[model samples]
Target: MEFHSQQPIHPTIRKCIQHLDVIKADDKTKQIVYMYMESLLRERDLIAASKQEPIESQIHN
Candidate 1:
């Protein structure tokens, strides 16, 4: 849970936290934002993985 000084947080994550704080978001709203963020992160990961795969493999499937 504790992040040491050596490990820096991601900018997107930091921005999300700051936005949530500024809005004084409620629990329900916070949950919605969290879910949206999760989806975005998952999609980004999938895109990155696809890019790493060979073009032939991508074309076949």
Candidate 2:
């Protein structure tokens, strides 16, 4: 679930998420927004971690 990219995000993903964010105005929509944001952040964190050398993998087992 990790993406490895040091450069700027692709326009497609950014725009899609932005659109999703903008579409909701109600409480139910807020729930959707919360889910979307959390997912996006988790994925972004995984991507960043993937880019770095994992500490566990570096040490001899």
Put down candidate 2 lDDT per residue, 1-61, tens digits, no spaces.
1234575545555565566567745556545655576678779998888779778876887
lDDT of every model, 2 decimals:
0.70, 0.62
Candidate 2 global lDDT: 0.62
| Candidate whose TM-score is highest | 1
Q: Write down the worst ten-residue block by lDDT for model 2.
A: 1-10
- Candidate 1: misplaced stretches above 4 Å? 1-11
State the weakest 10-residue window (summed lDDT) of model 1: 1-10
Give lDDT: candidate 1, residue 50: 86
Those runs of model 2 whose alpha carbons end farther than 4 Å from true positions after fitting are 1-24, 54-61
RMSD for each of the candidates: 4.4, 8.6
